[model samples]
Target: MVIPIFLPHLGCRDRCTYCHQGYITDVSGEDIKARIDAAFIHRAAPCDVGLFGGNIFGIEPAVLEKMFSFFEPYRDWVRAFRLSTKPVPLRDETIYLLKENKTDIIELGIPTFNDAILAGLNRAHTGQDLFDAYHRLQEEGFSVALQFMVGLPGENENDIENIIRNMVRLKPVYIRIYPLVVLKDTPLYTLYRTGQFRPTAFDDVLDCACRIYANAVKNGISVANVGLTDNELVRDMVAGGHYHPAYGFLVQSRIFIRAVEIVLKHLGYPKDITIILHNADIPLLIGHKKQNIMKFSRMGVTVKWVPSGNNRGHFEVRSQKGSAAGSVQDIYDQ
Candidate 1:
């Protein structure tokens, strides 16, 4: 069973320019309890429950006390509890309080650690604030996950590398990479409208993701999420900036591209080959916007994704009769 708890914009003191979540959730205590109870009946996730959204750290202590009370019934079944909050949420007293609550993990959205960029985004806390929170949380014995964004207005490309370097220095157990996604109805949208903000380009996003991917691989920190969860499929979405729901799969495919380079060396590479993956993973394997499949075709590789074996995450590629012959087993072996 996988149960994801989204409180969505509950306790934020500073409503970020891009935030619409303030209109999207139940901020009241009774609503929180009701939502949790309703979720239990249909939830399929294991005991792990994720707490996300609405300034989780900005709220009062009593809110959390009651919030935890709602979880007491599931404590035995719940193996872990995780939550995501702004990077500024990390305070010494907050650290002590979270420890007392037995939170297994705290995901801090550091967005970008660049001081100037932080101000540009109106991110209330500083890069120093993030590190302060991180160190305090570590000392108190909690697993930390840092979430970062790339390509904010006024930030240079080098800032991406710096963010990665800082995270490596921090040595968190988990991380999430979100290229700057421009959402509407927020202050960012206004900035975008006024030409005050410019999103990172797609090519740059791919390039940055590649660099971050390599460093994450070397660092051994699990990249839990690599992109946006909701793509532009929603009708009401305001704007687009490297927004793709299947961003993780694209990053994985990019990783596979690296692997393909190695595999082609041994198996006379074909100009085109059809890659078959399980049907269940069509969204992830094909990519959020069919970008992966299309991109491969444009690169002169005939990649075709077909439904196959029940293995959820497994994939196999076949070359057309006249195209070439590379062992599917060989690719899988790699």
Candidate 2:
């Protein structure tokens, strides 16, 4: 298990268009050390620690060292450290400090590859900055993960394609996809209030996210997460954008339905079929509120599912006419 210690805008130089981490995180700066101590105290065993919220790379090297010092007392119980930050202003001194510490993974937030979108978000960094930081981290033997956002102002399908292409090319250890949510008091929220920025339709944003996620899986890059964690603060602060409690599940269900559709097409649109999959994936196969089953019914196909001990992401569709076996990866391959 990994313990998350939220810094909550601790090192951020400037806020992104949609970022209001103070509300999302609800973590106070004064309680950081206390939070660390409390987390380690309840640990049953050594665990990985995640330093989340805020731009860690933007901090000065000296202050960064002082920040790392807080965890020194719990070094024995700490397995490794993972931190998230923007890609720019990644100084060599910061890289050396991360290496000296037990920080093994660095998650860079690269919202988009389009320079115009980056400027619109006020990220103060370019796509090239992400590439440079990624290579530098790789040279220092650090595992890299990427964080991407969808549904930003002025984003388009081509931008989503760009994300997929770059993700496949860079091949980070894992990735997280977040649909943009305009929070109260942020610039994005102001635009939403003034009707200056209008988010794309919810389904359209979800489809865009699914394309990114599917491409990542097909390329053998792990997708560690798909949406922001749901909480009361998030629910209250959400002013616009694609914020759903079951956003991740929705993406998985869409991918699963796509895979089933591919298999059915290969089977000549069978009238009846039994889907054999790992027990854990039943929810995805059934989908939220049985939507997948309803979709099959609407397509003039009868579907039944049986749990199997087969590995997750593995499924077989058998019909009277024929049978086809495949996974989500097959969807992209075809």
Highest TM-score among the candidates is held by which one?
Answer: 2
Best by lDDT: 2
How many clashing pairs per prediction, in order?
15, 0
Q: State TM-scores per candidate.
A: 0.76, 0.95
Off by over 4 Å in 1: 22-26, 42-46, 89-93, 231-235, 258-334
**Candidate 2's error at 240, in angstroms?**
1.6
Task: List candidate 2 stretches off by more than 4 Å.
Answer: 23-30
lDDT of 1 by residue, 112-161 (tens): 77887777677788989888878877777889898887656776767877
Q: What is the C-alpha lDDT of each candidate?
A: 0.69, 0.89
Encode model 2's per-residue lDDT on 40-121: one tens digit a residue.
8877789899999888898779877877788888888889999999997989899889888889999999999999999989
CA displacement after TM-score superposition, residue 67 of candidate 2 (Å): 1.2
